[model samples]
Target: MPQPPIVHTHRKPLVYALVWASLPAATLAQEAQPTVLDAIQVSAERGEPASESTSSYTAASSRTALKLALSHRETPQSVSVITRKQMDDFAQTDVNDVLEGTTGVTVESVETDRTYYTSRGFNIDNFQYDGVGLPAVYDNVQGDLDTAFYDRVEVLRGANGLMTGIGNPSATVNFIRKRPTVANRASVAVTGGSYDNRRIVGDVSGAVTASGKVRGRVVAGYQNRDSYLDRYNNEKQMFYGVVEADLTATTVLTLGHASQTSDTDSPLWGALPLFYSDGSPTHYQRSTSTSADWSYWDNVQHNSFAELSQQLGGGWQAKGSVLRLEKDSDSELFYQYGTPDRQTGEGLFAYPSQYELNTEQWVADAYATGPFSLVGRIHELVLGATWSRSETVDESRYGQGIGTALPPLEEWTGSYPKPTFDNGISGSDWTDKQTSTYAAVRWTLADPLTAITGVRLTWLDSEGVSYGLSKATRYNAVETPYAGLIYDLSHNHSVYASYTEIFKPQTEVDRDRNRLDPIDGVNYEVGLKSDYRAGRLKSTVAVFHTEQDNLAEAAGTFDNSVDSYYRGVDGLTSEGIELELAGEVSDRVQLFAGYTYVDIDTANGHTAKPSIPAHLAQLRATWRVPGTTGLALGSQVRWQSAIRQNQGTVSGGPNDGQPIVTRQSSYAVLDVMARYDFARNWRAQLNVNNVTDEKYIESLKKFGTSAQGFYGAPTNANVTVSWTY
Candidate 1:
């Protein structure tokens, strides 16, 4: 049946123009507002920002770190940069909110900043800053970085053998610190909303000396928020400062420090059972209150960085960075498991436990890159070497295995009624030391094309100390290779491709008790780039493939596992196509859209690899009425294909082909935001997330034959107010 079409009532141009003019006049007479430029500051190199579009190429501009960390397209590898402008507009506090829509990037929330990033089919446990590489502390020590401290984030999509030599060929992320500019600016903000939350933040930066040689920037913030999960609440505060000095006409040095502390009322190791005699979601009946006396823990993090650069004679320049990062977490945790009863509202539990944990990590590195001459010809080159070491120690044993549901909601606090694994996982320690040497160069084969080649060799040694035994494994030096090309399609566009090597040392050993060969990976990628704005719009589309050898398989847990818990290089493959379009339609209207199609397979014969999805699409549009400059509105839509659970069943169960439950059902999520210019120095904005209130599962904790579930959150939004003087 066709519906009737029809009526167009048009407002006269004279009337519309008159209303538009009157509105602004009235606003100006009653309130003075900030300029539109106040909401955004972009470092879109080459006038075009890199997004997921195949038509443009983008690179991180040393500024705008976390702000546009999710937007840029720079390398043949898929890279996402979420900009501070985007963060301010959406008031994104958690990194999860900023990355949930990235192509091939899955943001799985275990808790607040404990969210994890999974690409293709693996977790990113190594991260770099400036030029320093750090061991990503997840299991034992995990912490969050306040977005306010970053200028921008640079992401290289494939094996970053040249930058961070220890990780996957799947991806790498770098956080570039914000430097002091030759300008003075200061701002502050306060916020309040759902769950009795409150927060405050401040940012200050500018030239501190008359000569502008000595400049500094600082950012500090604090927040307290109660959550909806039982025994869950989070409070945090952070301080970040950076200072720079120009000692000579051609030399620059920068020193910076960041520190943060967070106390969580309660954080679950994993959700309780989600099923009972019948199959249904238990979350619906569980207590909304958090534990009264539980401690997820209060953690602190610190990063110290120093960088120096000098211009040698000729076209040669050398730069290097020395940095260190530390994370510490200590807490006691207890909780029960179960699905909520359909009628009683009480969650039924099948297992429960009490535990305590303490974790710490520290890493340091230094490297340099520059251009030089070989013979009489000029050679664009990069040369560097680095060393890193880390140690992880955990203490505990388990308790009595839980066999039934948890008690009533009122009994939410206290030590676990019975613990598992005996005394708990106590006196467990693992230490690793790695060193790398690398050198690379880019040659201009012609006016239209450039080629890059590089290699990294690393040596690794790790030891486990526990009980009365210490087991150690040492890997002789291993060499990794790389090569890439960029062919200019034109001044504003290019066709580029590259192949790079990757490797990750095994934490668990193989049969015969020898350290297994590291997992090796190779990445291949090709794409195009563009520049549209006098220097603003950016776009890109590309295809990538990665093959990893010796993927891990657990015969047991991260601790006690059966012999040969690790396998030799088998076959693990991932291939995908990505596209993105972003930039200004006008000074007031901005648009960004991205799409990703993936084809990933596991020779181990599993279908779904953890958090990776097959398809993802997203679009966002912001329209600041051209004439009514005081008001702005924006909307976004994100969708992904259904995810398969690749878990195989055992004896009484099934095989590998059987997937776990759908944790993320390729559902479309919506988000909205609006900003109002209240006065010259103040602005107000509202942000809404998960607007559709869709029911989804984020992850499933499987214990052999037992599988329990945890439900994802529905709609959650917050409001923000800001001011400047």
Candidate 2:
């Protein structure tokens, strides 16, 4: 692939205007007289700087998006942070749970353990661990990392070209780990919930040396639960440990390890069929099971990491990190689908299969950041480089009785005999490698005005070998650019505009056995950000447009001589607006709210993306009792518009080659929570979700067919007790 020239000429006028407008502020600041204060008195009264966990619903500052310590209003992009306090209050345990409540994000489930996240009409493919990028693969199962070891999760919307080398222009999520604390602390908790769910967690941290230069922390958790579906249960275990040492006054070294494992019995592969053979809709009970009792799925993941940080002269700082990860999964499941007869319940078939996967990944990065004087103004700059590699192997076997008709639904029970895996087949072995060099600068053109500009140069290579066939692909020296301008209108308000680009390499081939060009994406965004009550409350209103081109699509019929042919097409375009508010509204009240509206279209407009709602809204609030010091109560409500199922044809069935478009109704769910601190170091809480128990479809066609219409969870409640010392 050839590199494209950097484009900045179009944004020069806007950048100039912001710089000119800030000159007055700069002049006033220089001419104003400073008031002298009593140094001794001020020093005695000043408190510690706020940490990330200070607020229940908002963070004081973040460094995930740009590797710069900045407040929400200081960064010219859409960013949302989910704090530990918020997660604890809601009893969120995993990455999926945390993202479900975030602004402009949506989660859809394809199976019992598989989920997909999306934002701005595109799939979110970028995930970072402590600012280091991780590979996102589609064919393998994701571990759905546990949140117990993380202090917070930060989401940056739009193209993150500088940090993530190549990906979709949707968003990037960064999980910030909890560091060892200087002071000793310990805590333990136990929880019991509906459907026989039980969980226990322990956390401890302290200084390992008498001088308090070495610190260590450990966290462990276990959970066992049974689902609403019949004969389905799961067990999960997590462990994390870390050590931090101050080799010198200005240098630090850290090492950490994390492990997670999950075992599930009778895992569901897909949902019940949505329609009957006669073209009429079918409704099944939410507790209906499509899995047999003998099937199971097991997954395990392990990660080890090391980091070093040093302070150089002239206020400069340098940091480096290395991480290795290993993951494995094995599953034997049944997928029952196809339209059934309305009266006699016939024509339903079962497909049983088994799969095994193993993956290993290594990633490393190093960066240096500091401030410099440019034209008598102080500006900040960061330069970094990253390298990563991943390898995956997969194997599978299918049952011989696949496609055989099952008994009538009326006489069927949840218990069914497990099928045999006879015809075995091995999938391809794949490897992916990436290297990138990136640089960013925060230029203070004048007081109250700043410009952020960066670019990443990337090289990617991939190879696959399957069943005696081998292929290799490469994308060399591709460039992705980013630019943003932020102007402060007042002490509490700011307006900003940004532009970013995305590059994604494709593996499709043309008629002549030549690979197609990579897909290109450009994103444009403008927004207003505000802060209230001294950074305790934050809000943002943003509008964005994204365009993608050079999407590989089938162009002509398959040729026996050279396989199938494809060509680049004018790709998808999306425009949307988002609104978000989070943090303390008053002394005793905290709130979080968000809304999104998106419109998407393609060049031909022949097919629409399924299961994407046009409108979404969420709100949650908590209030402490005025007289009762330890009592608090909260509630949450979520609403979304109708979704369309875009299944094109039945493909050799009763409704063969016929269009099958089904619309799922909109829905709203409600939840409530209460907490009481009975003693100084003891507390108890309860949470009731889906209070009304409304039955609705959570997703339609999450797996590219109406046969996978997943139902939402029913009403459930949980209670927790904790002790701290």
Candidate 3:
């Protein structure tokens, strides 16, 4: 995406006055002058614009960690921002697709509808919207989440304890929504591609009142597509609308609503068998599937929010916001297990079931930030508080045949008789609540030195019943401390170091049938950051080390009730190094690239997390043809080291009690794209992914004789046509 005209974050009379002041000079000029220069100069006085239409891969500043607007050179963390333009160029319409291209992040597509993410050798459980945290009730993405309603995705790598109540030490992902604009503008896009894929999206934003005091925006889209896997398809619909009103000269009120639905057919419940009866790895075609013709999983989600902000005197501001989120899912699925014969393909079984789950959450937060002077030096301080409550309910129904043996695999199709769901039903109900207060300050210690320190106090309570077990937990006055220092090495270079603590509440119990204490850890990092090309380009080199205690590990023992238990493992450590560069290299060339290397020490000869690769690399760039007007070319390359999983023993087959293993060697994927602008307001783009058609497994952790595993997509192409006014 190319850079668009810049605009102010908050629309006010001062913006209108500045625009009018520049108009006269532009009108009197002999040659037509680009008005974007004037807009950029004026918008610079205010905060940087969101990445909505910036068309650049880098952001000028972000406040995802401590609610302070600081540039990458000033912040003491590694961050990656996926801009809207990058999404359009690569056709990354889903969150999984986007994160797969990010730096130091891994997307684990364990199942068709269930996904997991990890970073720096830890699981990611923290997610935010426009700087506000929202806990994941299920700790997994249950369905495909579209990106049509978001302007950009900000990824902060490493532990973030101040903002997110539960610090997981993995990463934090923040989604920034598209807001209403003071200028009237509209755009529509139509796309079609391989597998009979089809989609259409529309966006309209402008002033609702003649005086521009009130503004509104609307975005809607629909997509239907077939997958490379056999007997699988999905349809999606999404809508978002927001309105902003300037109630007074220095006060603003905003309201927004967003909804999305996913309807999928033949979604997989469990993956194909990865090993044969001979204890050897099994290979299948890329188009192979384990779903029945009648199996389906559907999901819907709705979100509503309201915010009010007041600009106080002397550079001080106060803001309050509330958000409500609801989600529901329904599925009827079939699971297959057992290793079959390598020659005759026999000895497999099936289990059928139905499930329904629902989740509701409410979150609200308020904060005040401004500058203060002490000892003839100026500094900044922020104070905030947050409250959140989430409830989840689920029910499961088993079919008549608990475990029915299957026919020969070679002759078997998804043509089994639908079992009668006459068995009894079981359900679970759980609720969790959290309250937190935090304070942070930035002190200008010297001419070239700066320091930031903060702390958070959190209270947690959870209660409910899971299956036939009781679930109750409580914790009070959990304190997490944060501190950082930065020293300016030069006008455009800086060196920094930071230390932070992490805490996560676990649901598993110890062998004694007692709920284990929460997991706690600490992180230390130091890095060098530099800016070039007048802040249009940025680079960072960081080294991080994390030490964790009280991590849950399987005890390999069952309690009196036959339920599995776990024990706390301490002294686990992970250390890594990261390198990144993003932004325009020159007038006609732009690039974003990164490389990450991590090493883990289990500290007790425990089986390490083999699914996380030791090395990762991502490269994306775009170049404009010098002689050809309105023509550009781009490409993306991603590579990762080998990953493997050790499945204990083949069960219930000719190779019973035999060791099995699944592995995917190191590989790289390449994608190419071309875009052409034909008319004043129209353009067309073509994107081809996996150009080499590399065949690889999407995830290895979910691999076993019966559980989960899938293949990545093959060579595919899509064409998009867009018009803007």
Candidate 4:
């Protein structure tokens, strides 16, 4: 499939503001009280019943990413937070490992550590690091940061261009980094697993100045997995550091950096077939390889960012952030596939390829807020603007080989995935600049009602240079609007609504290089939300609809250029319901649960996007006996509906005009964990994943699939221990 264009998420929302109206006094605020939901008792005017928590726009709301992480209750939107504690418990290295049990979130692998993320049944490739916007990429990718560098991970679902710049209304992911501590602290951990896996981690933090005006922290970690997939194996190294300084009593400065590199000797795309005659889904051996398989990846990524904050006196506050990042990947992978030579029972297939990609980015933003009451009542409105730029280039080559999928054992000849390296840069040079002007106010209206209304105007200008085909070509771009509203019922509950717009530019264009109008989309949402339990529990339920216009579907499989793909006659639309919950019961017991139901169709009522699972559900829990301080147990079960892969088409394959087959069957997996706190300074833990060893498709696979093919992981596990100082 042609990759989706990179999307900017920090841009302001427009157009949508003109289509929706703000309800009277709907902003909600949490109060100083207690209830079943606890910590989040706030008031609204939208007729929502009083609850223990709230999703309000009060000046005290929407703090740092850490605040969101600390919150266990419902906000007006669908959100999830992964804490440092959770990372420590699992000794998680990759983002996929860290979020496996989180509610409202799912992570799956296409190959090795390379992965994908989805929320509310939509592909959410965009992510924010410390509130800084990052462009979304279509390729299977990995974030450079390790769990040792993050204080927490925050997930915000639905239209978010108001805070981000550009993106699908799907959802946004933000990774909050840990800061230096004024107190000294240190810890270490080691891990071992089934695939001959081994890992070690070290962390240290403390004050650098006598008066505690300056402090710093550092983290280092490494992991090595020998693997169960014949020659597939890898080793990863991570380093992270953070520093904070108080220039004065009211001013402070903070900076942080993270770097990671992974070297892989093998990555299994697929195994050899046991019996082509059987044609059953289950046909593979544990220790299978077509040839003496080998793969390599020299991956490197680094990120550095600084933030400044100063109290302006009064009830006002101000903050700003600047960040820079760089990423480079060089790799080679080969495998085998195809029918065997009848008598030899050996197939003649091979795939060999090599490529490199380099990307770097710089982004900055600033915002201010204070008191304003021009609408009706008093409100603390926030005003802000952001700018970001990223440059990426790809170089590749192809050879006759089996495929990136199957292994290349003794039976294969002819390599197909030959690297196109000699062909030069066949892609392009890209850049985008955007600015937004937005204001949000919180109206403290009648008794239990409050409202928050915000509007933003954003302008975008993008240019790209395609350097292949013997000639140099370039293209330029243009802007759009955004608005949102929330109604509070009382100190505990509320209902909210939001309308946002998204604008994206495509690299594929007409023969003349004339850039087409930016593809546009509008999203609408109305829902109920609440949270409580003094930082322990939260729940949110909502209904939403999204419509995109001027979108171009497949002009034909290979002709994905703008000139070739016509505007989709029906467009794309989606409507759905979602519920999420999380919390801790009595410190020793904790749980997270969520469910999503979605309906999507072409503007003309055809099929939905192939990647997303229509229904997703997960429940996880951890518990320990109150009196015993050493032992604990954990379990998580997840369920997802079959994936929707293809639609009727004439130019493609055998089923021309017939609905393309391959529906990933609905499947479930269960994982368990056991922990022992041998002493105050030491602990041990073990995790069992996919306990049932069920075989099912976990990805929206295509490549050479006939009908329904491909399968998820069979099963895996890891064990670890820690020591504190």
Q: Largest TM-score belongs to which candidate?
A: 3
Order of all candidates by lDDT, from best down to worst?
3, 2, 1, 4
In order, the Cα lDDT scores of the candidates are: 0.60, 0.77, 0.82, 0.59
lDDT of 4 by residue, 429-538 (tens): 55555566555544456545544455545555555454442112222222334444556564556677766666554443334433344456777777776655554565
Off by over 4 Å in 4: 1-75, 90-92, 104-108, 143-145, 268-282, 286-292, 335-349, 373-377, 399-427, 466-481, 508-517, 551-569, 647-660, 701-710
lDDT of 2: 0.77
Show model 1 residue runs off by greater than 4 Å: 1-74, 111-113, 138-141, 277-293, 335-365, 373-378, 397-405, 408-425, 466-471, 509-516, 554-569, 604-611, 646-664, 700-709
lDDT of 4: 0.59
Error of 3 at 528 (Å): 1.0
In candidate 1, what are the lDDT values of residues 1-725, reduced to their tens digit? 22222222234343243223322122333444433322222221211232222122224332111111222322444566555565566666755656664555666654443556766556666566654665564322255556667655555566666556664755566665666665787889888876767889998888999988888989899999876565577888989999988889778898999888878876655454444323432454333333324346667877887878776644455666677676666655544544444455466443333333344444444444334333233345555667777776655444455454556544445444434445434455777677877666555567776666666667777677543334365665565666667787876887788776666765545544444556876778888866677436777788888888787654433333211234464688888888877666677777767887777677765553544667878777677867775798988888877764433322222232333342446788888999888899899888887798877666542333343345566677778899976
Q: Highest lDDT: give the candidate number.
A: 3
**Rank order by TM-score, top first?**
3, 2, 1, 4
Instruction: Summarize candidate 2's per-residue lDDT along 463-483 as a digit string, tens digits.
Output: 875433343667676777778
TM-score of each: 0.81, 0.89, 0.91, 0.80
RMSD to truth, every model: 16.1, 5.9, 10.8, 7.8
Candidate 3: regions farther than 4 A off:
1-48, 408-410, 510-514, 554-567, 605-607, 650-658, 702-707
Model 4 residue 10 CA deviation (Å) reads: 21
In candidate 1 the C-alpha lDDT for residue 452 amounts to 62
Whichever of 1 and 3 has more TM-score, that candidate is 3
